[model samples]
Target: MDFPVLWCVLAFVAINMIGIYDVVHLKDLLPPLSMINAIAAAYLLDKYKLPNGLVALGIGVIFFPSMTAPIANLKILLGSAEPPIIYGKAPYVNPPEGDRKALGRWIKEHTSITDMVLVHSFGTQVQVYSERLSPTIYFNITQTPIAKARFYHDLRQNKPAMILIPMFPEYQNLVDADLRSFVSDLVKSNYHLESIMYNYQVFRINK
Candidate 1:
């Protein structure tokens, strides 16, 4: 097998191990994850024609975790009356929750921090909505993907002034807190917090 294909297979086995491990250890959490994985597997299976069965299985394993990571994320659609907060691959902007205009204004006002922008999953929003700001972008949700190496890059070099989260929900405060904590861990804390609304909260990073 080619190196890329072999690496994909290994990734699949590792992910399947994670799911199996989750099933064995955290049985309660496995069902939702399993359901999400099943959906992704069945969908992707139909879309991609993999000649090798083992390769297909590997792809399934690798893809399942991202599909099922959020247990209650699906509720926004089935339980809601209005439009969902996520559609297709793009995240749904909850009305009054995450105003693109507000984000743009924030970015426009902080033009000097253009190089410091790092939106986690919705990092694209900054580039999409903030027309006034020409950002160097140390990390973006769509364009830039990384692990821990981006830490010093964002803090030391880029000096990101804020984080733009797009799929920010209305009810899941605890999950939101955890997500914020994860984002905050990446930056230098310039201020305590600039603002916190219902859908999104803006943090004023320490320069």
Candidate 2:
């Protein structure tokens, strides 16, 4: 009867309906319920003496996540799972957002054309608006060491006038250890906390 394909199609249809209902009504995915549905689908197939196809389909629904969940649970028990890195291109900032808009305005008010600003990451917004030079716009996985070295070199050579710490909620507490350490050192050495407005920290270099 090709019941597997039929069951799969039915499952997909059910999933789509739930998704549409969530968007139009709940506005939340209700992920736990989704997981419950997947498990229940498999259990019902087995209990009903349905073809092995449906049971297999049900198992397949949650299989990959079932495998990974144990590892995720272990990591949570031990500590947090490693923070994920976000990537971006230079001179192409995301459209000025809530805090980002405030930051852009502040940079324009204070920084000058020839000034150099050190941004933790996501430099494009300030760089474009301030017309100030930045060491790098975004962190890269492949060139972590190179990025670190270049930042050190920039500190020693260019000696940026100000360092901007824009507080992106996702990355506020999730920066790489090396990058965090570097920023801590800079703050201790020459940078002074000028202001913290709208989730942005402005650090001006000591004269």
Candidate 3:
């Protein structure tokens, strides 16, 4: 066996073992596996002197199952079928509609460009849509003690024009206990609730 092919097999096995213990998605494995498959196929063909028809049939049998989704997507692109409503990371689907979108638009229209916004427990969609800056680039600040301290310091120093907090069901459970308490107390003393969107609370800094 070729050294490069042997290395690829070993790497593939190692990655598979790691995946067994951790969350590894199929998409992450496709690239490396595809290269390995190609190299192995080339080696087999060179060694066996396989007939062209047999090689084509083998390739079709091996790859037909994986071609279904891509073919369907191609059909959709060619306007043969209506696209599905996919949420989260699908470029074809419409932008999500809800309190997040409303709040984003409100912030963009109401606040000045220079004003920073602090979003708690919610992702960076609001800041992205509003085209406003955030005190911290990270959306989740309660991951570690150091991260929490950095976020708190930045929050105090920046003094954002508004704070967005999720009010959806069980949203608070996602946040850290100490961080939640600190933010609640700070908001009560320094900020006031300006408006309540369907699933979010917007707080503006006190004058």
Q: Among these predicted structures, which one has the highest lDDT? A: 3
- Best-to-worst ranking by lDDT: 3, 2, 1
Give the 10-residue window scoring lowest on summed lDDT in candidate 1.
140-149
Model 3 lowest lDDT segment of ten:
87-96
Q: Write the per-residue lDDT of candidate 3 for residues 130-186, one digit (tens) a residue.
A: 788887755544455667777788777777888877665445656777877877887
Instruction: Write the residue-wise lDDT of candidate 1 on 1-207 in tens digits.
Output: 654455555655655543323233454444555656666667776789645587677877876765552544566556744463333233434544255566666666765643445545434454555553322343432221342345434445554556554444532432335444655565334544566422455565665
TM-score of model number 2? 0.47
lDDT of 2: 0.59
The superposed Cα distance between candidate 3 and the true structure at residue 147, in angstroms, equals 1.6
Worst 10 residues of 2 by lDDT: 85-94
Q: Report per-prediction Cα RMSD to one decimal.
A: 12.6, 15.4, 7.9
- Which regions in candidate 3 have their CA more than 4 angstroms from the true location? 1-99, 140-142
Q: Provide the lDDT at 181 for model 1.
A: 60
Candidate 3 residue 185 C-alpha distance from true site, Å: 1.5
lDDT of 2 by residue, 113-149 (tens): 7777766654555556565666543321112566567
Q: Is candidate 1 or candidate 2 better by TM-score?
A: 2
lDDT of 2 at 121: 54
- As for TM-score, the candidate ahead, 2 or 3, is 3
